[model samples]
Target chain A: MDKLLRDKKAIVIFVAPAFLLFTFVLFIPICQSVYYSFCNYDALTKPEFIGLGNYKQLFTIDRTMKIAFKNSMFFLIFSVVTQLIAGLILAALLTNIKKGRDFFKNVYYLPCVLSSAALGLLWMFIFTPKLGINQVLAQFGIKGPLWLMDTKGYIILPMWVIASVSLWQYVGQSMMLYMAQISGISSSLYEASYIDGCTKAKAFRYITLPLIRPMVATAMSLNAIGSLKFFDLIFNMTEGGPNHMTDVLATHLYQQGFKYFKYGYASAIGTVLLVLCLIVTFIINKFVKVDNYEM
Target chain B: MTDYIKADGWIDTFNGGEGAFSQQTYDGKIYAVPLNIAAACVFYNTEMFETAGITTMPTDWQGLLDACEKLQAAGYTPLTISAGTAWCLSMLAGYLCDSEGVDLAALDAGTASWLDSNVVNATNKMVEISKYFQETAAGDTNDVATANFYNEEAAMLIQGSWAIAQINGANPDFENKCGVFAFPGTDGRVIAKSDSLAMSATTKNPDAVIAFMKYFTDDTAQKYTAEVGGKIPVTTVEYDASKAPAQLAYVMDVFGSAKSTFGFYNESMASTEAGSTFDDAMVAIYLGTPVEEGLQTVEDFYKNNVWNK
Candidate 1:
């Protein structure tokens, strides 16, 4: 073991596969993107590099890119915060309840078990103005505007609705992570709190919440990562419609890369997405330091 | 999906009219039949009209509104669409542009601008249509119109006719009930969206393919489209409008008078972002957005994604 650890050649062999994978899967594509971002390269012809041209256009000239970027940021903030808060509340509720707890756990976890494709179709019926929940609302004499089909400004409210669906479908994993962390905290701490005549609220505020902080960070980080790549349910639902009002980066990448065959431009968008995700996750880690904590 | 040849001897005797280009080429060539055709028309519910005591089918824009009011007053939703498919909006946009006599091809090819006075005015026309019908649209569930039409929840739907197969695939006893008409926009010209089957570069059986095409376009296949499928066959064929099912006769007439056919213009023809940006602007306008700001967003996106870059 000592000999192997001391051998630089052995260490190099161990790190080589990961390094090569990072180069192939991440670095090389990003470098290609950085190069393409300067050019008006539409996949078919030879690329013409004009230096920072694409980036400059995206900022100064592109209206849709601004909307795309804003929509992505909206999802990132809303999905992460809502899912974390909702998950924590449900997880905390489950941790306290003594009866029918398993049933509640299964019920709340059901959306996670569903494939997004199936959920999207089912939700369509629910949101359909004629045949879905909107129709049901109509029976009670309530006329409803088109929900997903309405593309007028929401003043940020539609973002809330879309984010809620995202959070609903995903909170299970976060809730489970938080619950697992809460369970691992020493029971003796709860007993000691009671012996000291601390209220249940005080015990929960100080003991349960602080003990689960690391897990909260982990859940939130995962949620942020998820919100950034969101495509399927959004695709199946609005398809970035009411004229691409609900469009996101991943789906935009999909359309440009495959449907339109603008490979270079799509790659540039993908590279920007990767950098944004990395920066966000790094900032999160800096604040919480989840990896450094232990129960 | 099933790959049986339908018996070559039987195909030879049964009728070779429908395959057209495919019929002439395939046996001497590498491969075979059934190319795609795009179909869009105004499909309406006969049952709804009957229930509302309306005898004549709505043939123009005002006529469509009159029917919508009649149907809605009679306790039915006037129109239905599925925004989930999304391309429907662009189809609507295409039809709207065609109505205005603005060549969508020119628009797609960079010869025309989406924000041009004509195109913007056309878009305004569509927002007017959206408001007129108060169309009940949801996700990719336009086929819901088929049911709503049958069940009398909605009176009409504008959709691609390829969906005729999917709609009729259901075993509902709609009494051979639904019919189609050419798009009636701004009352100036009538048109339909046509789907085509482009020849792929890779073909091992070129002669067989040409033969199959010829066979498919023959009268036999054309009749199959009218009588069995209710789709408007491309090749000209003589048939009795009265002998056809009630729902299908209107389609033949509509197909007969089509001034010019268009395809899904925005997604198929525009640059990467133009169609998408235009699609969003349309939805915004439909939801009561100001045309000035909406067109500005489209113009900025158009400049960056197309002209400026």
Candidate 2:
């Protein structure tokens, strides 16, 4: 078995299918997007080589690009911070409670399993000014500010509303990851810590958190990538409306590529998004400080 | 191998005559046959109008505003428009532009700017009229807006002739209550769209395709267009109005009386991108962007992206 593992032919045979699939499906398309970012292709016309034009326009003159970039950054920061803190708290609470743990876990994780498109539509109704939440607010003599339509301010009210809804839907996944990591830590360590007069909080800080650093890195990276590419919920809710205020990078890319047929400009946006995801993931991995703990 | 159908000889037989070929013609030749045409108009609830004490329909810009004021005074929502769907707001802007006589051709040719006085006035007028829209107009979908009108929550909806079918389908009882009129201030001009038929230029069986195309504009089909589909047939074939939906009579009257007709501003733009940008600009105005600023964005888009192309 050892000799077979080291065989070059065996390695090649094992890696060939995955490598080929990756090349055709992911690598090739990414390369094409990078190439297209520098060209003027409208799907119907032959691509014209235009060096730095799309990028120049995106950075310098495009107001929508600025809005999209700011919104994406907001979503990324909002998602990562909230998911980490909320996930840790939920994981700690659920782990200590032996009774009805599964039931509580299922309740928290339910939204993560539901379709975002369906959830977005449901939330749209809830947030509509003349409907759901606003109607309840009206009953209290409180005129609710348009939750989904308010376009005032830089970040805008709708962006915050959407970000909160996204957090509600996704925090469960983060909680589940942290819970799995917590449950994997030996109960003997907690027993020893408690015997030494350590509080539950101290045990969580020294034993549980330090041991789960690797998982935290993984979860943060997952979350960073997910938030940067966030599209479906926002698209279903706003389609980047109230005059493009809620547009993140993905929806803006969609508008440029599919709605407007500016494939080259859209590719430029896509390239920016890809680069952003990579940089964020790298930062998360580097900062997370995962030390191998021998349990 | 590449020869488009020339329907110029038979074009005059259509309801709008040669004018119906406005969309189907290219380079001094006709390429397709229009089967049915539809126009956008104002559909109001007759009961709501009577309750609002509007003795007569508005005929011009000021009168329309006055009518809206009356409707609001009577505790009725004056208008229900879909700003959430950009095209619906853009359609309203299109009518305003038409009323102001903003030359679409001139704008396309770069001879006129979107910020021109007429265009600016048109946009301002749109903002002025938007005050009477339903409370959630900015977030309401087209379906919701239509529901507002048919449900009697709103007194007016600016939609196309195609809405006749949707309105009737949603509430058959709304058949008699709904009445149609041309958009005020356009002097009876309407924004029109049509479904046309064209044979493949390279088809081996041209005769077969032609036979199929003719069937669309034939008496039976044309009659069905009005009676069942609640659309305006392009051909001059007569149909029984009594057999058609009651709202059809009002729409037919407006269509018949239209002094002129033009295509949707969005559809008639240089590119779909330009059209969508126009939609965004209109929606921006609806969302309280200054009229000059919103129109400037559209002008900037035309100058940078469209005119150069």
Candidate 3:
């Protein structure tokens, strides 16, 4: 293996298939999207060069695009914060427990096994106006706001509902990741900290946190990207209604491309989303500073 | 279609009849066969109406609201609308537009504004009728709204003749208890559309495809469509009216006596983008967006996307 790796041609031959697959699957589509974003095409007519016309309209004129951008940012912030915090807490609890740790972990992981479509339908039922949360609230003399249909709560509540549902479904994966990272920490560190007049909280803050910085970076990047591309749940639920209130960039792109057949405009939205995700990941890595501490 | 003409596989079977096939003909060459002709109107449960002591279907918009109020007061959910599906809500708004005499063609031609009095009045009328919809109407899917009517929780559904098969599939006995009426209008016009099948121009086996198309227009298929499917037949074949479902007969009567006819708003529009904008505008009206603002959204979309093109 070392001899083969020493030869540059042999190395290229070994990696060529995967590299070609990646280029065809990811690079080609992204290049096509970038090209389409600059043209005015509707899939039926020949594409005409418009020179940033789609982007200008999307940023300056489209009200739904503004709403979608705002909503996507909200989901990104909340999903990253909630999932990371909840995962850490659950991982800590699982590690400190005396028994039934695997059972609890498996139970938390069950939702991740289900498809997002099934989870979306389940959450839709739970948020249904008459029969789900509202029904429970009625018995306590409290009228719940129309969970999915409430327009007044548009800016905050609906996005949070979606964020929390995503959190519920994927937090287990985060927890397991944290658990794996935490388990790798030596028992001697906690013992030394205890002898140095430190409590469990202090040990967690100074020892456990620094050691797991790399894992935190990984989790944040994954969750941020996932939240940015969120679609199916929102699509099956309100479909960006009560009149585009819950609209996100992904759903808006879908409507523009599939429903309206505005391929150029939709590609513009997709390009913006791709750039936004890359910027977000870069910012998160800078904030986390994954290389600051040793493993 | 030109390719099929070149290949000698295309046929002009209808000979310029004024129904579905003729609607699709271009320069005296037919390219498709229509499966059924359906209309958008009101479908009500007979048992619910009898219990509510309603004797006659309304003939105008105001009278329809009066009937809805009575049904609501009679301990029944008055209507079930699928606001979750934008087009379902737009169907009622489209009929209301007809009653108010808003010419969509003129609007498309840029001679009319969507914020005109008639168009605004039509939007307001949809808001008026929305009060009688089920409490969960805005959240209900098409399937759920249909279920609400089938479960006897709602007295009426503002849907098309296509719903008859769905109702029967839900409860086979509903075929006998269901009744149909024309959508109320200012002068009594109704909206109509055809569900048709189009053939590909380049085909490997034209004979088999032609046979399938022929089966759809034959006597047995036409009668079966009228009798079992509760749809209007486009063919000249005859079927027993008494043997046909009552709701189908009522729809036929409404279609025959309609003062005039217009195509469905979504279908007759110049582009799907314009149609979807109109649908979203109607949904906004239901969600408390001002009538003028909602209509203006569509007008702006039409100007920018359709007219500019």
Candidate 4:
């Protein structure tokens, strides 16, 4: 078996199917998008090469694209940070619990199983100014700001509200990742620490944190990429609105390509997003390398 | 392929008001069939109006406000709008622009600026109307707004005549209880657009598709549009006016008596980019951006992105 696995012909045969699948699924569409980004095409007419014109116009005249970039960055940073921290805390707590672990796990992960669109609508209803949170607030003689309709506090309030909803929906996912990593740790290490009079908090900081660093990096990278391309929840909830204040790059690309029939311009935005995701993931990979920790 | 299709006698012969028909044409070849001449207007609940004591339909801007006030006084939300879909809000802005006489042709010719005082006045009026909308309107989607009207929670919906069928579909009896009216303006002007059917230039069965297109505009289909869909029929086919849906008759009457009518502002524009800019600009005004500055965004969009392309 070892000799067969080491053969060059066997290696090619094993890798070919996945390689072909990736080429057609991801590589081909990306290549097409890159080609379209340089042309002026509206789907009804033949593409005319405009060469950097779409990018120039997007950066200069398209105001919403700028706002989209800002909003995408906010979601990537704020939502990722909150989800990671909350997931870590929850996972740590769940690990130490003696009973009802599966019950709590199922409860926490319930939202993750629901569709993003459904979760978005639920949050939208919860935030509705007329009959949702505001009505509840009014009963206590308190005035609540409009959650989805807000424009003045739009850049701050609605963004965080959406981020929190996203956090609620996906913290279970990160928690599961953290739990898997935490479970793989040898129990003997913790016993040794206990013998040396190490506290649980101290053990976590010195041992668990270092050992799980690779998993954290993986979780962060995955969450960051997902948030960067965030569309469905935001599209269903706010639709990048109250004056385009909540637009992420994905929604902006859709508006340009589908709504406005500017295929070339949308392609340019898509290319930028794809490039940005690749660079960020690469940086995360370079920095967060896993090694066996020696205490 | 072109020779084969042309040999099969597939030529578009649809003709209507230039604005209504031109959307489906390109380079002097008719690419589509004009199905219905539709207009944007306010659909109101008749029972709600009587409860609010609005006896006569408004024909001017001030009277519309008075109706809204009465409706509000009667403890009903006066208007249900979907700001979540920005174009619904823009319909109001477009009507105001029509009232202000912002010549779209002149705007296209680069002879008029969106920042003109008349356009500013129109934007201000839109802001005034925004106050009467439901408190949750800014967060509502088109479906939600329709549900508000269907459930009798709101008195009015500002939408195209196409919403008539939607209303009927939601509640079969809503057709009799509902009423339609043109947007009140200084000169009784209204804005219109159309639903059209277009054929693909390359087709496997050009003859079959062309036959269906013709059948789609035949007398029976035209009358169904008027009687059932509440849409205005394009062809000159006489149907019993009394048998038409009450809302349909009212819409036909409004179009008949209108002092002027313009094509929908967004559809009349050269490109969808300009159309979307107008929608976003209206949203800006509704969000309390100064009227002039809001119009300025459209002006910038038009001058920089749309015009001279």
* Index of the highest-lDDT prediction: 2
lDDT of each: 0.68, 0.90, 0.83, 0.83
Report the Cα lDDT for residue A81, model 1: 84
Candidate 2 lDDT over A36-124, as tens digits, reads 99999998889998999999999988878999999999999999999999999999999999999999999999999999999999999
- Which regions in candidate 2 have their CA more than 4 angstroms from the true location? B1-13, B16-18, B197-215
Q: How many backbone clashes does candidate 1 have?
A: 49
Q: Write the per-residue lDDT of candidate 4 for residues A176-204, one digit (tens) a residue.
A: 99999998888899999999999999989
What is the Cα-based TM-score of model 1? Answer: 0.81
Cα lDDT tens digits, model 2, B77-106, are: 999999888999999999999999999889
TM-score of chain A of 2: 0.97
TM-score of each prediction: 0.81, 0.95, 0.93, 0.90
Q: Residue B232 lDDT in model 3?
A: 88
**Docking level for model 1:** medium
For residues B1-309, what per-residue lDDT tens digits would candidate 4 score against the true structure?
Answer: 223223433332223334445656567655566788777788999999999999999988899999999999999999999887788888888888888888888887788889888888888988998999987777777887888897888999988888877888888788788988888864877777778776777688877886787677778988888887878987777777776767778788778887766777776775777887788788877877888888888898888865776
| Per-residue C-alpha lDDT of model 3 across residues B1-309, encoded as one tens digit per residue | 434433432243332244445556668776767777787878898899988888998887778888898898899998999887888998888888888888988988888888899999888889989999998887777888888887788999988887877888788877778888888754768777777777776788877886787788777988898888888888767888776777788898988887766777876677886787788788878977788888888888777766777
Residue range with the least summed lDDT across 10 consecutive positions in model 1 chain B = B1-10
Backbone clash count, each prediction separately: 49, 0, 0, 0
Candidate ranking (DockQ, best to worst):
2, 3, 4, 1
- Error in Å for residue A65 of model 3: 0.9
Clashing pairs in 4: none
lDDT of 1 by residue, B1-309 (tens): 112234343234322333433422334442334333335777777887888777887667677778878887888777765544555655777777766777656754567766678877777877766653435654434565455555655677777766665666563465366867677763534434433333445778755654665566577876776666666655556655554445555554665566545446554444646776666666566566787677777766655555654
Model 4 residue runs over 4 Å out of place are: A43-46, A128-144, A286-290, B1-29, B46-53, B168-177, B238-243
Query: Candidate 1, residue A2: CA error in Å?
Result: 3.8
